[model samples]
Target: MNVAFFLIPKKDIVYLKEKSTMRQALERMEYHSYSAVPLIDNDGKYVGTITEGDLLWKLKNTPGLTFHNTEDIHLSEVEQHVQNLPVTIDAQIEDLISRAVVQNFVPVVDDQQTFIGIVRRREMIEYCSQLLLQRKVE
Candidate 1:
């Protein structure tokens, strides 16, 4: 029941660096077709999650801030609406499922708190569905 079993490795995930520009975050999110993405620090630790809402809010509140000129805004400066917090690598599936209840993916990190991968809600649903079906069959 290790969470790693459900992990979508970091290599396949589009994540934002703490120092990346708001423009970079937007481009990466658009490229990956994701509404939210995990933000990692320079040391590879999970900082927080950045969502489309966070971006829009920043635009609406910040003076003179527009999509056309996001180069001056750093990702770190944009207030993040953090979703599911990260789970350690050794965390169980039960823990993953609980967190996925609130977010699309549960960010997984190592003992050092370094970003590793994510367990998507789709995977959690499939696992629970299979479990439920097995009970019905029994």
Candidate 2:
């Protein structure tokens, strides 16, 4: 099956811009209650994923960096420990499954490398379980 079958379109998801501030990343993640979120560039390309751990580490390691000063720090300054790889729009389900095993969501991109959407592991597992159930019923 096509990977698009499980995609949650970019329009429906919350992502941070490459130029966003560290404070912006924190507020967005906290408001959405997401542990991790995809990062996109101004050109709309997928950059990487940012996690809570990344933010925490940044604060812990950076001397004299307080929550108030986070606004002065760009999101780019924060190191992304987890590099969530992206797959093209035409990728197969097997490709998505392989990446999903290690990532919470597999970032999706187009031929131009523009950020498209993401496929969550939950949807993939549900689809696979349904397939297995159908086979058992047959």
Candidate 3:
């Protein structure tokens, strides 16, 4: 199946800007109940990803700093250490699933490489479950 069949539309994505604070990112992550979120620039270009682990590491490693005081810390600063893999909108569903297996979620981009949305592991699993159920019904 084409990725478009399972693509999480841009509107449904939870994303943050590069200039945002780690605290802001964390808040969004918590409020949305996501383990990770796609990072975007002011121009809406897909830059990378930030995970809960990344936030925890930052809190643990940053001496004498608190999450409350992270307002001064830019998202870009944290994203520098994040693992971001490239993914295209036209990619097949199987390839997207493979990438998600290793990355948790894969960022989708347009032809210009602009950040569009994410294909999350949970969504992939749900899609697979639906496919399996459909086959079983048949």
Q: Which candidate is the best by TM-score?
A: 2
What stretches of model 1 exceed 4 Å from their correct place?
none
- In order, what is each prediction's RMSD in angstroms? 1.0, 0.8, 2.1
Which segments of model 2 are wrong by more than 4 Å? none
Tens digits of per-residue lDDT for model 3, 1-138: 776766777788788888999889888988999888888888889888888887787888889879779887887877345576867888888788778777877888888989877777788899899999999999
lDDT of 3: 0.81
**Prediction 2 TM-score vs. true:** 0.97
Q: What is the C-alpha lDDT of each candidate?
A: 0.90, 0.94, 0.81
Find the candidate with the highest lDDT and give its number.
2
Candidate 1 lDDT over 11-64, as tens digits, reads: 998888879888888888888899999999999999989998899999999999
The true-versus-predicted C-alpha distance at residue 61 of model 3, in Å, is 1.8
Q: Which scores higher on lDDT, 2 or 3?
A: 2
TM-score of each: 0.95, 0.97, 0.85
Off by over 4 Å in 3: 79-82, 133-138
Comparing candidate 1 with candidate 2, which one achieves the higher lDDT?
Answer: 2
User: For candidate 2, lDDT tens digit of each residue in 42-126?
Assistant: 9999999999999999999999999999999888789999999999999999999999899999999999999999999999999
Clashes (candidate 1): 0
